[model samples]
Target chain A: MAFVVGMLIKTAAVPIVVAVVVTWLLHRLERLKPHAATLGVACGFIAGWFFQEFSVWFPVRYLDWFPAAALILALLPRVSPITAAWLLVPAFPKMVPPRLWAVGLLTVSTYGLAWFLNKATDKIQQRVIVGVFMATGTACSLVLLQSFSLKFAQIAGLLTASLTAALLSANKPYGNAKGLPFLFIGLMCNLMFIGYANTSSDVPTWCFALPLVAPLVLLWNPGSKKLQAVRYALVVTILMVAVIPALLVHPPWEAEH
Target chain B: MSRNILIICAMALLLTGCNSEEATNPSPDAGDNTTPETSSGSGFAVTSENTKVLFVGTKKSGDSQAGGFKEVSGTIGVDGDKITSVNVVIQVDSLFSDQDKLTGHLKNEDFFSVKEFPELTFASSKVEGSGEVTITGELNMHGQTGEISFPATVSVTDGNVKLDAKFKVDRTKFGMNYTGQPDNPINAEVDIEILVNAE
Candidate 1:
């Protein structure tokens, strides 16, 4: 009962603090009205959720690619730069996950070229800008993985080969930390299965603190324009990389009651 | 105003003291143990051979579970009732799981960031035996250092020495927080179990 209260406190405390800080920043810089700021916060929250859940799929992750695809519409001088700017966020993590990177690069490049085209026409929509950038970045990443080959089969083959190599190397005891999360999940599934058959123990009180600190830091000081944008990207990147291993390496017995 | 600053400072100091390492077990029911001064009967000499240490921790809730930490390597020096010095190294990536893909990701940036900060280590400053062994040490993990204590039991029988301790570790100290699957995320309180044999 105490643990549950603590966890709720921890979870609520951080996000509330973050919302305050972010709200302050938007008001200070963008001079957005209170209502507009509220709307933006809601949008940001939704966007965060999208980044968390949907980005796993290539198409959703690469939504930023749509702006680039709108290059035809983005030919308008005002819109192209804004769409281009969003690219900086996703590109921060050099090694994004396999699915996200592949889809993102493909979609971003395709849309980016389109945006470049629209840049000549000047009919880009604000909504489409984020999407085009996502697509273009995803598309370009695919190209880079395939060493810029235009051939689709070659690109798919390269992706498969890369995945196979990563998996093969992961089977060994050591090499890179990237392989730990998968192992952790397997252990947890076994535990959960056992937990279903038997009993599971209560998690300790302090488990609630992990998510609280980092988000508070990011929200409070989104920092300079470059850093503010990069900060979110950085937080997301680190979490993306670390969560799986933390789970894989987790012991099965602890879950036992 | 300056008053707010002063209040903040005072609050910080209070927190520091609250989190500071205690000399012995936090429970009053536990025996009161202090560093012994004079030598008693024949001091139990740790067999200068065949001593090893084991550490275990678990994620508990969220995306992870519980298990023994496999890559623990450390040294124990005992002199009479006092443990003069103890140093230990835990490979954060050693937690085992069935799937290979997840383990690889555990070592990635979202988790241990093993490349950036690989080892979780502790060096004891003082050890005293009352009923249970109380060892206070400086623990270093994820680039942060803090003083912590582990309640332990020590015994010497035949030619072997055994040391056991159980405690908790917080992963937030190392800056690992990812929310994709919060239900099974890394548990902040990593239960640590240690067993050591001294030579």
Candidate 2:
């Protein structure tokens, strides 16, 4: 009971509070509006601490570094040149697992998606952007909890929670979440990459790839508020109708009674 | 504002602790990654089939669960009638519990974290006594090293050696900090049984 409570406080309660506070503070400071979208990333960073890492932050333990990297990389972009963020790129994937060089592509993909999503979704619906990430996050956490490391699942959960709280707290609508896409992609990629690399369960390789393609559900936009619900319904439908059955192919380990 | 800054800094520090070893680029097979020293005559290879390394963890609910490692490899060296040195390596991934789910959970970060550490090793520094013997050495697990001394029974016959020992290792000592559920807390001390047959 205490363990569950502590986890709730650390991963859920603390992160929600931090996200709300950071988003609120940044919203109040007129000059800081451009920095508000980065709120979720920062909240995730603070939450990372309460959830102590599996091992000490040994150089190899960068598996737990996704949240921290998102905030740090997005820090200067709100105030300075975007190119400055590139310097932090080399830090991730000293070795994500299995292959040394190929995992670097995963790192590259994170930055690439961040740039693409930022540009593509700038004018898109806020409901669409947050919805896509939240849906993908839900699937990632579920898969990770069932098949991969639980910490990775919890990591995914906090990323989604912090981002949701921060994005919604900002008073301004779509414009408030500056650099939102970068933090979203980095944090998501971190957990998914960790899940894919280290999962000892029987989940098929293709099933793990499902979350990456989840964002594509947004492509079929109805362009109306009433139809915004379609995006989530489709994602859940694909995950449930397709994913859950596949995941069930290899039932997760269950506790003994 | 300064207080907020302090809170943030403290959180960051917790993630990246102080006094961390340099990215020393240590070899993949670094810590205690050697067989018994060859300088002390011939080394006895551990008969993989004859060796056993098992552990028993008890929960507060009085439901005691048992598990063991499947792959245990080591060498026992002997000089005359006395055992000179011992090196044992346990592959964490090979750990199996009573239930399949428990096996998977044991491999997660809450337990062995096989992906991160992979192996538990013990290399003896000193061996004392003949019939009722004691071994002292460093036990490395979860990236932390602690010296341990345990009593054992050893018999070196010709070129073969048979060893058996039962000891309790505090899991917390190795940084395995999971306390189980509050209602059914697991004991911190876990029973470890070791049996090695070398011929």
lDDT of 2 by residue, B1-199 (tens): 3563455345434533544333221222533446746576678876458799989998887878899999877788888888878888887778887776678768876677666667788889998999679999989887678899899999888867889999999989987877756577889999889888778
The residue-by-residue lDDT of candidate 2 on A1-257, one tens digit each, is 24543663466666666776777777778887766657654665556545554534433445434444655656743221122222222222133433423334444566556656666565666656776777777777777766635576667777777766644753433557777766777656655656655656766766666676666566555777678677668767766643685457546433342
CAPRI band for model 1: incorrect
Off by over 4 Å in 1: A1-129, A136-257, B1-64, B156-160, B177-187
Residue B91 Cα positional deviation in candidate 2, in Å, after optimal superposition: 2.7
TM-score of chain B of each: 0.61, 0.82
C-alpha lDDT of residue A214 in model 2 = 64
Model 2, position B31: C-alpha lDDT score: 38
lDDT of 2 at B81: 80
- Residue A51 CA error for candidate 2 (Å)? 5.0
User: Which pairs clash in model 2?
Assistant: A1-B182, A37-A177
Candidate 2's TM-score reads 0.81
The residue ranges of model 2 lying beyond 4 angstroms of the native Cα positions read: A1-10, A51-60, A76-99, A170-173, A224-229, A241-257, B1-34, B38-42
lDDT of 1 by residue, A197-240 (tens): 11111222111112112222232343367865675565445433
